[model samples]
Target chain A: SQTIHQWPATLVQPVGSPLSLECTVEGTSNPNLYWYRQAAGRGLQLLFYSIGIDQISSEVPQNLSASRPQDRQFILSSKKLLLSDSGFYLCAWSVQSYTEAFFGQGTRLTVV
Target chain B: TQLLEQSPQFLSIQEGENLTVYCNSSSVFSSLQWYRQEPGEGPVLLVTVVTGGEVKKLKRLTFQFGDARKDSSLHITAAQPGDTGLYLCAGKNGSSNTGKLIFGQGTTLQVKP
Candidate 1:
């Protein structure tokens, strides 16, 4: 079975501070990885998706960026955090296109 | 851009009651999926409907995909408090192969015990 791990489970960062959230998948290779953010009372919004290492497609222009360093390791980063950046960040992986995505426990980020 | 609209953004019903939530879209989809999310957790896949006019049942939950593949619905029979959560509908565009998805705003359901 495949599992996704994300950390830190909860984060409190000061405004303008750097941010790094890591997600890794085990038991699968060359899986599609995605980054999503869910604001309070809002649906999950796709931030970035990667088909392969170094191939990332961003859905929206924002303060965040994503990178896939390895086949199953994805990272979401930001040089400076904004108050609006606070939300629940999720990492998901899928075996192929148009397939069901398995998600991690998620990271709750609060920028104060 | 393709958009999915879900109705009854917030629903509160008593236990053992039946309720239905609808997801609508103008664009056709190759596949549609429904997910349930609880507080502090990622959304979990409940069911997937692929063919047009598809009806799938998972326990007491019934899911139906529209005949045109442009809409879907989730009906719960004798809901339980454990069923309370955010219900989301997501679709894969008919032309995309990157596994990209368009998601509905989501419906929040609270089943009171």
Candidate 2:
């Protein structure tokens, strides 16, 4: 079965600090990857998605950026974190154009 | 702007009670999906409705797609405590939209003993 992994299950960061969240899939190659931010008691907002290596699309203009450094690896990064950037970050992967996307464990970042 | 609007942002009921949550959209969708998410976890797919006017049931949960493909509903019969979670409805509009999803503000459900 395919599984997705994300690092730093939880983090407490200071405002203006750098942020990097990593997501990797062990069983799939060339999968469509997505990054989403979910605030407490709120809905998931699409931040970015990548169809292939180095192909990234931004849905909402935010401090966050995403990259597909490897076929099975996706990274979400920020040069400087804002308190507004604090939220639950989720990474998902799908196989085809229109299919089910499996989600990783998710990273909860709380900016103080 | 939120493309999909979910009704009853919060709901609390006793076990064995029945309830329905709605997801409405102005734009037409090719497919609509329902998901259940527990606290501190990612949403899990419950069901997907593709055909217009289609209805699919999973145990106590019944999912319905609008005939015009603009909305969907989830009905739960004889709910249980295990059903307590956040329910989210998402969809992809026709060919113009790929796999990208427009999600509804989730409805948080609490079922007590």
In terms of lDDT, the poorest run of 10 residues in model 2 chain A is A94-103
Residue A103, candidate 1: how far off, in angstroms? Answer: 1.0
lDDT for each residue of candidate 2 in A1-112, tens digit (9 for 90 to 100): 7889998899999999999999998877778888988877667898998888998999989898898989889999999999998889999887857756678878999999
> lDDT tens string, model 2, B1-113?
43999988999999999999999998888888898888888888899899999999999999999999999999999999999999999887677333777789999999999
Question: Could you give the CAPRI-style class of model 1?
Answer: medium
After TM-score superposition, the amount by which residue A22's alpha carbon in candidate 2 deviates from its true location, in angstroms, is 0.5
lDDT of 1 by residue, B15-97 (tens): 99999999999999999999999989999999999999999999999999999999999999999999999999999897988
Q: What TM-score applies to chain A of candidate 1?
A: 0.97
Model 2, residue B98: C-alpha shift (Å): 4.0
Two-chain DockQ for model 1: 0.76
Best candidate (score: DockQ): 1
Clashes of each: 0, 0
State which candidate has the highest TM-score: 1
lDDT computed for candidate 2: 0.89
Give the interface RMSD of candidate 1. Answer: 1.1
Model 1 agreement with the true structure over A1-112: per-residue lDDT tens digits: 8899999999999999999999999998899999999987668899999999999999999999999989999999999999999999999998867568888989999999
